[model samples]
Target: MQRHSARPLAALATIGTLVLTGCGTESANAGAEAASSTGAGRTIHAQKFMRLTQVHDETGMTLLEGPTFGKDGGLFVVDVTAPEGEPKVMRVNVGKKTLRAVHTDGRGTYTSAQFSPYDGRLYLSDFSHGEIVSLAPGGGDKRTFFSGEVDGAQMNPDDIAFDEAGNLYVSDTRGLSENEAHGRVVRISRDGTKATVLAKDLAAPNGISFDLNDRGLWFSELTEDRISYLRLDGEGKVTSRHTAIRVDGGIAQTDSIAVDADGNLYQGLHGRPAMAVYDRHGERLATVELPSRTEGLESATNVAITPGGTKAYMTVSGPDGGYLYTFDALAEGIRQSNGG
Candidate 1:
């Protein structure tokens, strides 16, 4: 692993279930099945915007998650070094479109990493270690925040996010069996004092995010091929659950998601070559064409959006190399309410 300054850090499917069940699948209808509307959202098509930037994962077995922006304006990413490769965190300057090593702790195989608006630190998920680790910027301060041994079953930490009040949430795609790999979302405190399971029994939970107002928690079930939502409580506990998007096809599990300022949701598809955009009302807004076939583009896993709602970033796990790609975002538009 490439160590840097102050380095410390860090789906299931059937036919429908089989396709979208786990991470990747060998489905004949994968492409066609992913090209339509799901859930309550209206399906819309998007024009090619901009191919802003592309990054190459120089080392590591797989670039698992991220492109998560930092307060200092750079992005944090994790490389899951498989089969005895030391995991690493890389910093990318979005403005300069350059990459640099931030931390190299040989910290097992890490799947994803995210910046917490509350703590100003980075939370990283180690899939092999089954734990969520925290790393100080530039690899300064580091420690394990939460371990992923839920109900005595091993967990594959996939994604993490935070709510308005700074509460941390993580997705654990446990595995296959009903109780075995059903998947669940866990919540951690800003101070790392409390760790709680917010929701359980989800099928291969992957990317997670909160609504614009932070009133609800949204998660993706890769195996079930559905995006689910849960109503949060005063104490940050998830109360009610519902489906946001349920695709009817081979398999269309989502890997990552981003939300616009206008309350729209954008999801990155794992197998197919595109991203799904949803309006606030759970209406399918747009399906943007991603660079899917060019090697790793087919496994476009994670996504991040600028706070200003202008541009979006996606990680392309290409064959020869993994890359970070940028796209122009259409913040939000209002068609004239003709008959209102």
Candidate 2:
């Protein structure tokens, strides 16, 4: 009886193995070949780059949006939502790989935060609070710096950057339901007293960075798959506008941007799960691969570079509690252009 039972089990296992092999073949056949670059009416296969290597995975659950460096060289990230449970600013000691809650505003969804070198204050844009709030220089008391309806308008202020003269720039981006093209870039004065529109009709402008020369501004439009530039006066006013780099045959959703010491612009291509480095002249130098394929593109929102300018840092969004990734720049084949 025992031999009879063992023989039947062995036969059943063999049948299951055959079924699995058939399924594997079918799955492989379902995927078409990846598109190839065309050359003189011929197809040239393009190799996919290596996926992003992990840097620091979060132990907690805070949804990190913008990761900026503090004056003390600490990495500060704006937690749009508190980790698994608590509500607060997600502060990471990169040197130690430890996480802490710096501040809890009760109002959640604080998307992007930056430290102002001019006054040593922390300027943050609250996506949920619907205002721009700042911390006392060196991280003390927190208060609303700019709030109460943008240009008497309602919108989501997602990211912000500052100019040399101590002026504040905020990305007042609108939601999907609204179709009035209310997205805008607003400049706030040093005193936090005056705010004015520098450019309008921007489609989901998410990240803003100053060029190396401090003569112009580069910002990303999430809905448009295009990086753009605006000429600015010493006082931070728009003189001209033009598209800098268009993501060819891909979505233009970008969340954060950072520049290396040499002035190359590195942008986080959110939903595409890639990082695109552009020469100062707006040409794409490389596209670094990311780990996950499901990120919303708008979620991998911020990029930061170490002072040494060798390694770059980026954050992933949501349920993943976001991750900090370090990138090694492959600068050999990349050309240095102008405009940074």
Candidate 3:
């Protein structure tokens, strides 16, 4: 693994002013209006209703991915600074607007962190170690939950989500380039003993989230710029599959996804200034344009909504540095797990 010198933390400052365009109403009101109106092709300027503020400035480190909320309302994030150096996991107090380190051991390359609704523990995906590690609610006592290959394939877990029954769905992003269909989604049993592939032949499957109704699983194919929905039976097996939405033209890469209580989907765009919003039936409801100078250069890597769905936190990665941004989301976010 290669190592690089760590850079100093940059002075904190407010990112940018909220500018709502194309629509007269504020984002919250516009979102409400867009949600109700049956008319298609209507655009809601999310900046009008939502206030974008910089919570933390990870100037020197690479905020690999995350913004998963714990039961206590604290948001968790990971820092993949150097391949040889230990990765750090930080927790953000959403209400207090403060950041603190939770776990920072030079163990493995950690990509994602999730709080299990059933177990009330935090689960992390160790990409370098090819294993899933668990931590106590307060980030203590790390232990291996699942490791080794699944069905003879090396584990390269990226994003993770849990169902109502405590089962885990992981996106195994095989490689960097999308030249081949090597990505797949794997499911680990509740007890963390058994693992199985739920879907395959995917081109860079990056994010996975359960539907608001709990009847389907939604995931994004980053390289392909497509989002898919999978219907599962009682046993959590994929029974049906279909492309939920596809992005074409400018800003075509799709990253992380989050669902709201109203069955609305919020997707992070790779090379666009806005995040795309979709209704339950796969209808494009709004395109939330964010304020940033690196609109085309940066990518909105991940998004997490609070349990109440009042606010949304998104991470943006670019040459300037990594930044965490928060804004008001009128709709309440749906609980990804059974626990609150």
Candidate 4:
């Protein structure tokens, strides 16, 4: 890990969950509105917007992630550990600070969500079930969108991205292998009649986003501790790929990511309530941190920004509980910021 400061840091997320860490406090600022200054950057802190979930009275843990916004400006989020029968896909009334589950037949482990540009329906990546499911904007009409046995094996779909044509791009994490190069980026045609593995044999492809003009995609491989950009051809096939950003090993894994109008990437870190910003060309911009690393609020797993604006929100969870934080984005928000 490249530490700009020599100061020691501390905790959230533990040894026994999807996040694999523990947290306790609830204060942290993640991103800020883009500044015109070209001098040394300052730390950006996040403000706690709401307490999304309480600590599991029994498990002492909760994982809050997958923050995405709908067309109507409704904020949607998911709980990775919410039991089978509970409402896992929830919509947060940002104005009222209340939450309601839109998708509630609940039987799958939904990790990430994004609304399809073509149909305006919300699409979620069911990690445990190895499927991609879609539901109506109001949470009705749940439908199994994709269930392909790619390479003759079930996919562990982690994050999702949709192109202008509505084709789905998914990150198949390969079931948590540290060094195994079995991960893949799968592309499911918009018609739901075909599935193609765009890229394979990856370390662990997690967060993903489409590039401007639908030319390609940028994604993070948590196991390798780096982010790469995959340039796609006219048909959304990878024609060339290159690493954009590479960071030293850190205890915290890279979770979901977002992109801004300028193409800057806001990469969320799993173990802390913070975010790392990188320019479109891969220059490290800044690290948005909590003003005070309050206990139990360290899991800044995923983030979402308002379309075409700088307003943003981050989803967090830990030993203390789950929360949503708001902050200014580094640049004007784009569609990529509201997706998986």
Worst 10 residues of 1 by lDDT: 6-15
Which ranking of candidates, highest TM-score first? 4, 3, 1, 2
Best by TM-score: 4
Per-residue error at 335 for model 3, in Å? 1.5
Per-residue CA lDDT of model 1 for 1-340, tens digit only, reads: 3211111111211111211111222221123223333343333332222232232233322444565777677766765542222336777777776777777664345667776666767777766567778788666588888764556666666777777567778787765434354678888788766677778777778778777677887788776767888899788876798887765425445666666667677776766546677776667766655433344444556666665545566665534345655555546311100000
Q: Give each prediction's root-mean-square deviation over alpha carbons.
A: 9.7, 14.3, 8.5, 5.6
- Model 3 lDDT per residue over 134-190, tens place: 888878799888998888877667778888778888987765433568888999997
Which residue pairs in candidate 2 collide? Answer: 61-83, 62-83, 225-252, 270-297, 271-297, 280-338
lDDT of 2: 0.57
Off-target runs (Cα >4 Å) in candidate 3 are 1-61, 82-87, 175-178, 249-252, 292-297, 337-340
lDDT of 4 by residue, 212-274 (tens): 567889888877778888999989888999888885426666767788888878887766677
State the lDDT of candidate 2 residue by residue for 148-238, as single tens digits.
6667765477778777666778776664234345678788887777888888888777777777777887887776767888899876878
Quick one: best lDDT, which candidate?
4
| Stretches of candidate 2 exceeding 4 Å from the true structure | 1-62, 83-87, 249-252, 291-299, 330-340
Model with the higher TM-score, candidate 2 or 3: 3
Which model, 2 or 4, shows the larger TM-score? 4
What are the runs in model 4 whose C-alpha is more than 4 Å off? 1-41, 57-60, 175-179
